[model samples]
Target: MEAALDAGADMVGLMFFPKSPRHVSLSQACKLADMARGKAEIVAVTVNMDLDGLSRINELVAPDTFQFHGSESPEACAAVKVMQGTKIMKAVAVSEKADLEEAQYYAIVADRILFDAKPPQGSDLPGGNGVSFDWTLLKDLDLKKPYMLSGGLNVANVAEAIRLSGARAVDVSSAVERERGVKDNDLIRAFIAAAKNA
Candidate 1:
């Protein structure tokens, strides 16, 4: 978290999904959130979690945003926004042009939209798989709300990804890690510099 903040990240994500290697406990999330609260937006990332679970997180973490990376409908996203009074960033997995259609629906309910690569087959996790889709698919995207590009971004290719997708914002995960689930500060800094320079 400190590395990202030092690297001038606009947001920092705390994973709440148990199945994900990146998952953090409520206590851990609280500490990280505290560290990043004022410096950067604290985003609580979850899969198809229930409201009760989300409420518990909200009460403890007080995240600035809730990033829903699941099969949540627009109504579900809207409900969470009203319930928590926090911004929502809904992830839309894209493997093809047809996948982008879902972002249009989420745009109405979510404060921001995130375009991520679809999880590989047999993968239990929703994202953070180090997989990438066709960035060109988003070149012509037009939406009322702001959107972010994510999935497979790294120090080596983030600039190209941004240029090709025309993404104003981007998110990274496994690419900045030294190993699965472990973040490397140097990689984080390098990736941020690359993205910013792009």
Candidate 2:
């Protein structure tokens, strides 16, 4: 993360999904978040969450943004915004035109949208698979709120992804990890460097 920051990443993310090997306990996640806070923005990624869960996370990590990566309805998202009083970033898996429509619903409510690749059929998780959708899917999109481009992004492909999608900000979890969930400092640094220079 220090390397990524030095490489010019504007934000860093910590995943809190149990099904994902990248899941971080509140305490463990807190240390990582605290490390990145003020150095670069820290984003706490969660699935559908309850109020208590959010409160616990907020108390521990104090992230600058909450990245919701579940099937939470727009109304639920609104509730999250009200309860947490933190910027909300909603992730939508896009594999088709309908997905873009879905992105609109969250646009009105969320502070930002994360365009990610759709999880495979029967998959319990919605994102963090490192799947990259076609950047052209977002080419014509012009919105009131800024968005993050994600999915299948890595040092080798992120520059093109940013250019094709017109994304100024991006997110990655699996791409920087050495294993399923453990992050690699060198890859993280390279990714940040690659993204900034792109």
Candidate 3:
């Protein structure tokens, strides 16, 4: 959070999914966002949200960035981006080369694309699974704009991920946690340190 920002994280995220252990109540997330706002870009991570839902979140935390981590259509993302008046980073799961194809549809619509691991079909949660794919899968491929590499990233391998994938921006949720959802400040610092050096 504040520590990660001090370590040079341009942005920090707060999860809002009820099903996720990382989920935060409005007041809880608001406080965290308030603390991290001036230091770093605050991002509210949501999944399959409607306009009204998005409005509620937009008003509550007022995150500088919004990350849609679900199976949202290009039109849906575009509409949200326009409605929120904020930059939107649409999260897409990438496992194979074909997975990169979906990035094309969002190239013009989204402010950025977040490549994460594909969730299992029956999994209740969307992301934060700590599942990673081969970095070689993304080597040398370009889609323009800024992009984020987000699946299973941590202090241990973030440098390698950046070197192999050529992603300037990266995100993490589960990897910084000590338990399933409890974020560890130490891990967060270590991750940012590793990423900066990368």
Candidate 4:
């Protein structure tokens, strides 16, 4: 986290989904969040957590934003936003152009939208699958709410991905990992530098 901060990362995400390799418990999230609190925005990433669960996470993690990375509806996102008084980012699964339509509903309630590749069939996780959609698919998106592009971004291809998608911001996970669920400081630094320079 410190490495990413020093590399000029704007936000640091801590996952809460048990199924995800990157999942962090409440206690772990608290510690990580505190460390990154002043340096960068802390985001609590969850997958279809209920209101009670979200409230508990907000109290413990104290995140600046809640990223819903699942099949959560706009109403669900709105509820969390009103309940936590924190910003919400809804992750929309994109496999094709029609998939982008999901963002329209989330946009009405979410503060930001994250476009990620749809999980492959039979996959247990919703995101962080290390897959990417066609960047050209997002070339003409002109939504009212700001959006971030994610899914298979890396230091080598992020700039071109940004160029083709016209994305102002991007998210990376597997690309920065030395092994599954293990982040590499060098990769983090390189990715941040590449993104900022791009």
Number of the top lDDT candidate? 1
Ten contiguous residues with the weakest lDDT in model 3:
1-10
Query: In model 2, what is the error at residue 44, expressed in angstroms?
Result: 1.1
What candidate 4 gets wrong by more than 4 Å, as runs, is: none
Model 4 residue 43 CA deviation (Å) reads 0.7
lDDT, candidate 2, at 86: 88
Candidate 4: residue 71 lDDT (0-100): 88
Cα misplacement distance, residue 186 of candidate 1 (Å): 0.3
lDDT digits (tens) for residues 1-198 of candidate 1? 989999999999999999888999999999999999899999999999999999999999999999999999999999999989999999999999999988899999999999999999999988999899999998978888999999999999999999999999999999999999999999999999999999
> Evaluated with TM-score, which candidate comes out highest?
1
Q: Where does model 3 exceed 4 Å of error?
A: none
The CA lDDT at 153 in model 1 is 93
- Put down candidate 2 lDDT per residue, 43-113, tens digits, no spaces: 88899878788888887788888889988888888888888888899998888867898888999999999
Q: How much is the lDDT of residue 123 in candidate 4? A: 88
lDDT of 3: 0.87
lDDT of 2: 0.86
Candidate with better TM-score, 2 vs 3? 3
Model 2: worst 10 consecutive residues (lDDT sum): 1-10
**How does candidate 4 fare on TM-score?**
0.98
Regions of model 2 farther than 4 Å from truth: none
